[model samples]
Target: MTTPPHHPARRNLLRVAAAGAVSAAGLAAATPAWGRTTAAPASPPPGLSDPVQRGDLVVDVRDHGAVGDGVADDTAAIQAALDEGRGRTVYIPPGTYPVSTMLTVFGGTTVLATATTVIRRTDGPSIVGNGVLGDMTATGFDGESDIVIQGGVWDVNASNVALNGNGFSFSHGRNIRVYDVRVRDVQGWHAMELNAVETVRVVNCRFEGFSDPQGNRQYSEAVHMDYAGGPGHFTLFGAPDFYGCKDVEVSGCYAGPSADFPSYPRLVGSHGGPDGHQHTGLRVVSNYADQCTEWAVRLYDWLDGVVQGNQIVGGGGGIQIGPAGVQTGGNVVVSGNTLRGLAGVQEAAGRPPDAAICVGRLNNARTHRLTVADNVVEGVAMEGISVYRTDGCVVSGNVVEDCEGAGIRLHDAPRAVVTSNAVARTGGESIVVADASNAALVAQNRADDATAAGVRVTGTVAEVVVRGNVVRGDAAYGIAIGAGATGTWHTGNDLRGGYTTGPVDDQGSGSLTDPAGVA
Candidate 1:
């Protein structure tokens, strides 16, 4: 007999919540559905004990009729473990098990494959969580809490693979870990997709070879999060992809060569919405990126995150703070990173063209309280740090060199502070504040060997403080404050080595003089 249709309202409610579509009122309205539904049986199946302890049942995929050969299908041997009906660790010995289907596990379960245990798929997503329901069917398993997939290779050749999240109609799963694995050659979408998963840790893993067909031009990201495409409203989808997913850490991992689209290959990345609500609470530390067409790290709807000590080289942009049309605020600290070889459109042969970093505003929304400090940026095509339409952001203690454009460009910003930064050998202006206004501060920054002015301030900037900066060997003026600019204070700066002062037309009541100890 068919399983009675699980309560439609309740199922839809769960699906909506997982997808982050439910509103506050909708959530409250659906509460009764949850309360009224009879809970699933808590007891274990026959010959199974409650609170299924580890080491109780040991199943070897090889012994349980798995072929163990690199070319043989191992779906049956793998299913035997899941069918046993208890929490246990299924061990896969050192052999390549080729499978076309997705392998899923129940709650309180661990799938332990040795480093040499290779689960290769001729198709896509060798192992998956059966949380969401869709066509091109794969395995479905529940009990996500305390689930661990460690020490093996999950090769995905498919284009679209959806994992945990409310949008996938999953629930309350926590502490899922994927460690010490290699994921390669995903022919479809995101190699790894983490949806509303909490306390998830992915460490010591390698993700590579993301390729797509010509003209498809799809967006596949290596690791993506957020709630998208479910029955609920957008607000019900909850915080942005990484929001509310607390203490999520991605360390010691490598992601690169994100695929383009059309040939139906994987390797693209895109956010799910335009609502200014999602946020990312990510700690991307000690990771390495190279030759990724997209950004090395794309922070969408992010807030209060830390991106530090990461080595990012050769990409479209090393790190993109926020995409367009999102509200990103609160303590995004980027520090102690090394960025090099950011080639832009016109690079010499054999050199990639990209930017070191691009900090963009989301939908004209003001991003505030950003602290970018102590980073070394070298050989970038564009500005080392480019802030667009942001406020209350600070860039300090950074060393930028050999950039084709301005070392630091602040556009349409207010209440921004740039201090103690060393900008050198730039083909463009060393520091450019274009058309920015109101309470901006540029202090104690050094500009040397700039092809353009050391600092170029244009338009009407009110109450802008330019203090204690050193400008030397600039091709143009040491400080160029355009006509009609007003209310700028320039004090305690040392201008030397062929740098001359430009006309300072003070339109408003702002003083330009030296103050003691301004450095």
Candidate 2:
């Protein structure tokens, strides 16, 4: 084994040209030409020098003895290439490379690939940026910066690996960019997981076919980012799970699950530390989600974020905010999205049925200052939008149609405004202010074609004003005030196409200034 002479960058091009003939001859001739004989050597190929550079030191894996034949395990050859590409660009040409082990990517290294290049992972994660490695550690920030992974196709085989798996595992990095990549057929855990990361942006990526064909014993998603175990490890694996990340954004991506599998693509705030770092400063915008098990966009204990302009379809629910028990997440905006065909659970009796959008706590007031506006929800299983036990929230200019439950309901939410919206074809009441909700203004809205009533003010509510609305076409009562409703002011509403039972059935003693002549 002889080492090459120390040559300058210009000599690198000549070496590449000289190696072309030897590479074309055969893998047999490659032994002496580059001074390598074995397929899986104990160390790197003998006489291999530092990666050659043209301008920015482009380390082509082919020059480093990678066959990329899809049958042979190219893990060792690719690993050696990555070692040479520590501070440079690692270029993968158009070929399918089979990997049986993980590829560690150090910081300041760009793993760029052509669209025709495919990295097929038979076992374990395809690429890992920061994690446990021997007794040493690489935090992706240990004197490094700007780790970019762009433009490749990753195929993950769930049947061949453990339950906790991923295509790209990037943790404890800053300014990480994963863009324009395609991940296909991820079966076990997640496609991408970002743990304890800051200032990361994921843009214009595509993920498809996330499921467990064996059974639903394990949950899987497309992308997960969070603070789970350590910054370099996992407590629980979720697709794009965001537990304690800050200043993250996911934009212009697609999360599509298999038709047979029930899984979510975007999961935020799934894991946390005992100190409770609240997963803040996130944005999910301009994405498309299909066939999710639960909410298309699920947020738990997240703060200071915006979920806008996303098209979510064929899921258990559309968007969900807040967590169970006493956990609260607030100061979020959900606007300008199309949520349709949600609520995957129709008859399964255990968990409460899902809604198009749900905010705040289920049993108490925990979240605040949430604005849900200008969204469209159709064919929702339960309520289109429910503000439960939250304060200072605004639900305005939204449209709900063909829902199984109430179009919009404010359950014990105080100081809320439901204005300028349209509700139609609801299975229950079109709009409801119930459960001790106080200081509510349900004004300038239109409700029609309800199985129950157009607007129902029930429960022990106070300081309620329902004014300047249109209620029409109900089989039962148009506006039914339950006997428990009190301190209600209902006025300036046009009640037309009187109910089958009666136009207005006001059982409560609330003040009413309407022309319907109901006592």
Provide the clashing-pair count of each candidate structure.
Answer: 40, 12
Candidate 2 local lDDT, 1-519, one digit each (tens)? 012222232243345334444432353444453444233322223443322222234677776777766787877787887888876667676677888767877766777765777888877644454443331233322313457777888777554555446788766566677778987767656778767677777788888766565665233457775564543445322222333677788888887754443445443224433335677788888888876765677676677889999898886667777744435668999999898987644324575675688875344537778899999999877788888878889999999999999999998888899999999999899999898678798999999898998888888887677888898895597777788877677888888855889867777765556545255
Q: What is the lDDT of residue 336 in candidate 1?
A: 88
Q: Write candidate 1's Cα lDDT for 1-519 as tens digits.
A: 011123322233234225234443454455555332132222222442222112224444544667656777887687676545235566666667776555555565666666666776654333555232233221111225666666777666444433211111222255666667777666534556665555666677777766554423234456655443334311221222322334466777777653532211212222533454454566777777665655667666666677887787775557766644644555688888888886553224764343465666335665667888999999877767877767788889999999988898787778888999999999888887766646678889999988878877777666678888898893667877766466677877787658544423233444556565224
What residue runs in model 2 are displaced by over 4 Å at the alpha carbon? 1-55, 132-145, 159-163, 217-219, 230-243, 257-269, 272-276, 324-326, 346-351, 361-365, 509-519
Local accuracy by lDDT, each model? 0.60, 0.70
Candidate 2, residue 340: Cα displacement in angstroms equals 1.2
Worst 10 residues of 2 by lDDT: 1-10
